[model samples]
Target: MSQAPASGSIPDSTALETGASEPGARRPYLTRTRMAAVLGALTLVLIVVCAAAVMFGSVPVDFTRAIADRTSPDHAILFAARMPRVLMGAVVGAILAAVGAALQALVRNPLAEGGTLGISSGAAFGAILAIVLTYRFGGGSAIVPAAGFAAALISTLAVYRLGQMHGRVEPFTLLLVGVIFNTFWSALILLINSLVNLYQTRSILFWLVGSLEAPTYGEVAAVSALGAAGFVWLGWHARDMNLLSLGDEPAHDLGVDVDGARRAIFIATSLMIGGAVSVSGMIGFVGLIVPHILRLAFGADHRLLLPASFLGGAAFLVAADLAARVAIAPAEIPVGVITALCGGPFFIYLLRREGHRGIAV
Candidate 1:
């Protein structure tokens, strides 16, 4: 009855449907090929940065000799001090950044981070508690991390519960509740410090400010194992995260168990944060800054964003640690101080940007 459509022409019904969706559709800038290129580039940069971290510390050491000849004069410094610290930095940084990206998606809040959620404070409190107990009663170093992990999980779950209302989590409400919990834990840490001796107080202060000064090989291995496990788990759920970002109703309609996905992501992020804070103390901003930068460069696709964030974060902290080592030359600044210096301004910018949008989630 009707003439056939011309070759290369879409049918009228198809054309109409496509036009109807055009206004709401978003085109991604990073294609599969482009994402691969960017990831490869970031990985190369990470490798170069890791080498530099080992080579350029407070002391001058020949990079080639440090790697080639263990008998070289710098061998002890390279292996005993710098290598473990650098590896710790890499592990902690990657965990923070990857978890940050996942949490941001889960909460639908760009400002979400471990420190903001009180997870770091809770971990620090637990570690400090273990330190005090060990100092008085005597125990292995393992007690601190174990306590920290338990405390971090408890605090995160508490926050998660506080943030929910009528089975929904409002992003702004969650942020506010997290801030309150952080303040409460911070004050409690100070109170505990007051009760301890001078040496313990000093150690607690160092942990609070954060450092990568003296990580043992065993601590490095433990954190690496935990971090790798968390990364893989989060990566497996990356598709669900992408779907969740499209809004709850749409995600639910598409067969995502919204509440279950949220809970899983929350637990996964807490585990990553706990493992890191247990080892490195409260290193903030790496999580907040690394994920944000990568999201801008790539897109909000978690599959790519999560891995990219890990690599980028590893490189970033390694470089930051290197700067912390040499910036004072024989006296080191806390790595946290350097990250805060960078993150503080960025935080202000985020607030201002949100203000322009009327602070809507």
Candidate 2:
């Protein structure tokens, strides 16, 4: 691996690594030694954290016993509550982080995140609207998350369309548009909140702040399916993402259909973000923090960044969720708050050090 430039922006020297061609040999996707090592370690930690999350809770049942008595209340607690929550957190965190990485790269701004681009807020508005309507009329079953997904998709498209100027998108313009749209949606959400009753408002409040308050088995299954599909779609274009860092012209010259690829990726990522947010509220930090951390360690190559972010995000969220569980025990604080507590300050530090140049937000 080659060394990073003297600026010290990238944490590892791997960003300078280059490929050399050998006759009749397949090209390698990644060869960053440090990044591979970190990815392996993070994967191991994620596995342990997932297991711990499933086993640890208020009831505190042993995994062995829970496995033996799957039908009992304790086992039910493990299966119906903790396991689903942990699994869903893993999926959601991975998707958010991966999507964040893509958006940061696509927008060429370090400050850019899924929520910052207005997708999450749009999803929140949709979810709240669904809750409001369901409470009032009651009937359509799939309208809840479906509305959220639609809102997220529409918001992302709006951002993309509005940000485009002379056939290309400007990073600063995109950021400004996103900020404005997000504010508009937030105000609308407040109006809805004002109209709703206290109990419904309380539910919307927790959801807006972001919570993983044990989703239903059906929701878990739906989110899993969506995340898995999104991951595969992203993985297929991972190499193209690396080329995108060199700018649109070079990527297009390299035979990447820049617009088409971006379109596909944008849609898939919106689905991933919207579906996760719909199920678990607006858990922050995972998307905003995890991908940037992974980029620091793994360089800008999406081949490694994508998978590494998936594992690292999973580990980070599971750890945060564990802390949320243990911090208050019976009460159990929201996992999103815990993540923000840790990630928000780190984000500020990053901004202080690397604010002006090439920051995507």
Candidate 3:
């Protein structure tokens, strides 16, 4: 699952060239300045898509008036019903993309993501546990997310530890370990559901399917906070993630502290995944598919891959969520279901390509 480029592809140096006047001076097109322009274009596209998402829904509301009138019904619908969900999609999309970028580098596994490796499941278990505890303690919605965050962190740590074999962690081994952990956690969740009352079971089932059914303002704010933190933190590590594509030994020889970097990435990835799970509850494939698509579209440099995936991921989820809302008309579909339905085939396609021709890390 590692997003490393296939052997013999031109390096990112094409984005730059020697100055026209000098033999080796960098050229205008290949300059970092142009890369910034590309990123700006992506950002512009994402903004337009987000605006479209905010505008299209069951009851089409004029966004201009909605934003201006705090007391209008359209405002209520836009602010209370739609805004949070849109923001959640953006946050989750960015977090998932960033996590995918990091994990692919961390373990050199392209398929690595919060959902695939049981991190989301683990986080869900924690959140569920918190919910049960809150029910007993007479707590509120805030407690639920807090509990979920703890669970997500714990689950990711457990997976990381177990995935390590003889002081090394291979992508395939980590994938296997993640599957096992995912099964265990999923079963645990089911067991908890069984022991709980019927109401709780129904609630758990709904949450498990994943939804963008308009989060509370508090939830949206918290998700935004965590997501922003993770995004900022990971942006600093973009170069490290790029270097890591060469594999751990080579990365180490190049002065990258393999173990320390892995630890940081793991923690960062867990936090991002946990935050996303806490808010969105185990949406799958944004991570796996987003990075791959970016890889194909923009090449494998993490510098470009990371931001492109983020923008692409945000657009992808928002569009899918919009589809889920309109496709069923009055009855909204769980966003997770839609993403899986759409992304599953793409995932299979990726597998087909991998089987036919492998990328060397």
Judging by TM-score against the true structure, name the best candidate.
1
lDDT of each: 0.84, 0.80, 0.78
lDDT by residue (63-124, candidate 3, tens digit) is 78888989999999898888888888887888887788777777677877887788888888
Q: What does candidate 2's lDDT look like per residue over 38-80, in tens digits?
A: 7889889899999887777765776676779867777788888
- Report lDDT (Cα) of residue 273, candidate 3: 82
Worst 10 residues of 2 by lDDT: 20-29
lDDT per residue as tens, model 1, 1-361:
3544666674444344545545433333345776788799999998999998887888887768877988886887889899999999999999989988888887778888888778888888888888899999999988988888888888888887888888777877887888898888889889989999998888888768878889899989999998999899888889888887776777899999988887778777777787788788888889889999998878878888999999999999998898899999989999999988898898778767766776333
Candidates' TM-scores? Answer: 0.89, 0.86, 0.87
Question: How many pairs collide in each candidate, listed in order?
Answer: 0, 8, 14
Q: Of models 1 and 3, which has the larger TM-score?
A: 1
Q: For model 2, state the Cα shift of residue 32 in Å.
A: 8.5
Comparing 1 and 3 by lDDT, which wins?
A: 1
Q: Model 3: how far is 347 from its true place, Å?
A: 1.9
Q: Which 10-residue span in candidate 1 carries the lowest summed lDDT?
A: 21-30
Those runs of model 2 whose alpha carbons end farther than 4 Å from true positions after fitting are 1-29, 32-39, 62-72, 356-361
